[model samples]
Target: MKLLFIALAFIGVAVRFAVFVSPIHEFASQRVEFSVPTNSWRRVSEGLFLYGIGVDPYLGDTFHETPFCLGLLSKLHRVNPLIIDILFPVADILAAILLYLFAQNFLEQKVVEEHKVKTSFKKESQILMLSFDCIRTVPKLVVLCYLCNPLTVGSCWAKTTTVFTNLLMAAMLLSASQGACRFYRYISLVFLALCTYQTFYYGLLFPALHLYFENFAGSKTHCRSRGDSVFGLLMDGLVFIGSFAIMLVVSSHIMGSWTFLRGVYGFLISAPDLTPNIGLYWYFFTEMFEQFRSFFIWVFLINICIYSIPVSVKLRHHPMFALFTLLPLITAFKPYPSYGDIGLYLSLFAVWRHLIPQMRQTLIVSVMLVLAATVFPVLWKLWLEVGSANANFIYAITLVLATSQVFFVTDVMLAHEKREWHLKHGVETVDKTGKRLELHLQ
Candidate 1:
């Protein structure tokens, strides 16, 4: 496993480095929202220039990335290639490694814990163990899945900021899985805030992560009865708010005012940029009228933010699944959806690979994923480059793309519930009447 991971890591680094230096980098960086101009290595260099000139990168509306990221890249503006080439691949490698460790931790925990409950009428007792052999192969699989993933490589090579978000997310997951570890808990909260700063919707993951911590104490009441639970939740909340506020303050100071907040974060929430991507938001708002813009913006924001509640509650017992469930929905609803964001979830999907057989609608989901991946570029070309097709053409592909993701997420959620069911019901869940039990979603 070590040897396999080492090889994958090297190959991943080499692929990203090769892509960075290759001619194809320009094309992919410019054309794909997966590597948008504002967040691409090239534009990052442009933003870096202002930092060198003692001007704030966040001073203008041209840059959309986090201030700290811009400052980090600015420090590398000169002779940065030497380190820059390694930075992205290193981030990818780190994310994979972190996931491997997280899987190990999760699986180990599963092996140690089981709840046995006897049926009222039957002589049989059911055992619930949340962990599958889920760990033994998981670490290696995540390393392979993420490092060898084409989209992951593409996003890394394109120097898209989403790669960093993926890294932070991986770290956050690892930290959250570490039960009773105060250091990791604080670190997770900080990273969570950083992710929200970078990508607004990531704030939704807060509830899931918090729920994980709450239950990591063994039970809800156990966690609640402990004084640390109250203090810990309070401290975590403070850390989250403080970290974000500090970042905002530092960025605001650099920019000479609070204007950057509106220029950057506001642009994100308001849907002003009509750049085409896989999201459902851009075109819908693009076609919207000036008079009704404010109304629709609030409606869209509310619609997007509302899901975090139901999802967090439904899968609270399965916090990791709850976290995973939010990805596809965000992909479909976010203001600036891109393939990079999709790639993050897709690579992470390896963790759920064990549930493949139980996944209903797998065929339809696979076909949709394939269609979206292939047809999107064609439609994008026809709509933008060739001008032979209208916006509707690409929008149609995006709809398919988002629908495919939605189906994929739903199927996984269904599979997870089934697995949990099996953990309680034995291999066969039949009644005395010889009827099979079925699962249904509300």
Candidate 2:
């Protein structure tokens, strides 16, 4: 454990030093430039520049970050940009540590639950399950995975604000999963609210995470009455909404007006930027009929939420796995999806390493991510710069990327269902005909 923390610090400094020394500095040499997405780091810097010179950041479409982010970056005007560069790696490190703590705590809870159901688990099945020593080291394992992953390193190298959002999200997870005080759960809600304030899509997470919070906060000794649970959730919802509202108000006050409400969020909901990226949105919308764009935009946004609510309800009992499933959905469907989002979810997958063995097409999904990330720049250059290929060429790769990610989401959900079936009935999952049931991907 001591050596793991040492390695963690080393990784933090190493990423910072590498970012400083590499040409990826200032988004040059990096294919995924920050300017392409809404609320990008470069855009915030642009906003901060305007704010420093007595102009509003929301005065134009160039910046889409919340005034809170702009205000946070405004502090950078006082310090060197290199300091902010160092800060991102530090955020990554902190987030890694938080995720480690959260995973360890979650695993401990699972161990306790498993003990209560020990009789149901068969002997061989229990042998294949996580060992006590392995459980103890899960934190280090999860943290090391995050630190060593290319997606995480790439996102940190790109200097996107996602590292900060990830940090907040990780903290919320840690707080909600651990700690005993009544106030701890509310603190987690505050962080969740802040996360939604920073990124709109996280608002959908409210139901799932609140479900997690209820499960975490509920007592095993006694069943709370239905009316009490409803009242508690209602009050928590108010807190979440109230905190988010206060955050928005504070952000607006910081920017001196509500103008940012449009510039930042409007750009997010409406896909005005047709810049090529890993997502499915840019290419389709780029060629879409301009007259019907509005309808389709709503359709796409609704499409993102459509599964979230129903899935949240159906899989509400398995909050962690349900959240895990939703992640790749976000990576697939977000209007401004990026590899950074993939990294965020992949880190969660690491925390839930028990699910990996159940996932079908692991090798295919891994290959798909590598191919997608590696080929995008080359194909993009061929189509946009070299002019030998048409938009369909790169769009095909985007299709591959989206399809692979959606497949992963489904695979994980199926894996979770399989695991639950085995746990409840027995390790031997068989049909009524007495044949072993295999998890088949559709």
Candidate 3:
């Protein structure tokens, strides 16, 4: 097990290193110029030295950048898109480590607290709980889903989705999952707050996720005092407010008006009806839907099937599941979705692990995955014809299907019983006369 863990760690590091050193001539070589207040620090830094020339360093006519994002970027004396991009895979790996730590803590918590229940239930419920327990090792499954995902790898060169998602995931682990106390909770919120500012669409979702994890995951029930529980909630809210305010102020200052602010809010409140090309919202949803509509929904359904596992039925009362389900619908405010993003993908994987103990349930999920993978792309091609050839169409499809694949693979691991088999055989041993004999398997 140690060897396996080490090997996985090495692979994650190597992948990140490759991406970090990968040529950034294309990314840096783009001749576009200008600055958003959110990035005013870069302008200030360059201007102070009178070093950077020919790059458009103007704060454009709108609050083009979120404030904290600007402030954070401003602090950096150097702007290397290449270095920034490389940081993501490293962050992803860090998130994986955090996840492992959390899982170990969770298992330990269950053992100490004995989250165990009576084995006897109605025939159906018994099957359900067993399956749920069987999938207990699922959080580890999430680690793999995050690490080896092709879409995640591909996006390394495209953007910093991995880094932000990993930060958010760590936030979930610290704030939502059981562990060492207040420090982690605060740490989680701080990271979440900064991350939210970076991408407004993701901003609201972070708070919502913590709310879900707190209430839905086992955390809600574990609180020792109302104040402790409430503290977590308040911290997340504070981060949200602080981050959003920074974004707004910076954007307004940069743009010389509140137009972007209004537009951002407009996107949140209204859902207009128009041709895919006319309304941005309409285009976002339809294009996003059309690109990977068939596959994403199918994969989601497979997760649903995994949830139907007899064991997972007992966890129906869990707050995490509810948070996971509602989060996507709410966060996808404008209709454009990134399946490759960690938020949706990791949550779906969590659901899959929650549901994987029942063979009947698992088998059904398997079928759905196979079918979705095969059919989703074909449907996307058809949607493209209806919508006309969209230059950004492939990106949309890739994001959606990539998200589905993350969840689908997580589902597979949830249904897996390999870990249980290892435990049963007592991989631990005692040696007598240099002849090893299994302890528990004896």
lDDT of 3 by residue, 37-128 (tens): 22222333443232233222333332233433333444443666445545556666676667666555554454433235333223333333
- Give per-residue CA lDDT, model 1, range 73-161, as digits (tens): 76675656678767877887788788888878766665555422333212232333334456777767777778787777777877777
TM-score of each: 0.90, 0.93, 0.55
Residue-level lDDT tens digits of model 2 in 196-265: 8878888787778777767755645267678877987897899899999999888877877889888878
Q: Is candidate 1 or candidate 2 better by TM-score?
A: 2
Show model 1 residue runs off by greater than 4 Å: 1-9, 79-81, 114-134, 219-223, 226-232, 430-434
Task: Indicate the residue-level lDDT of 181 in model 3.
Answer: 53
How do the candidates rank by TM-score, highest first? 2, 1, 3
- The candidate that wins on TM-score is 2
Query: Against the unseen true structure, what C-alpha lDDT does each candidate score?
Result: 0.76, 0.77, 0.44
Check candidate 1 and list the clashing pairs.
none
Clashes of 3: 18
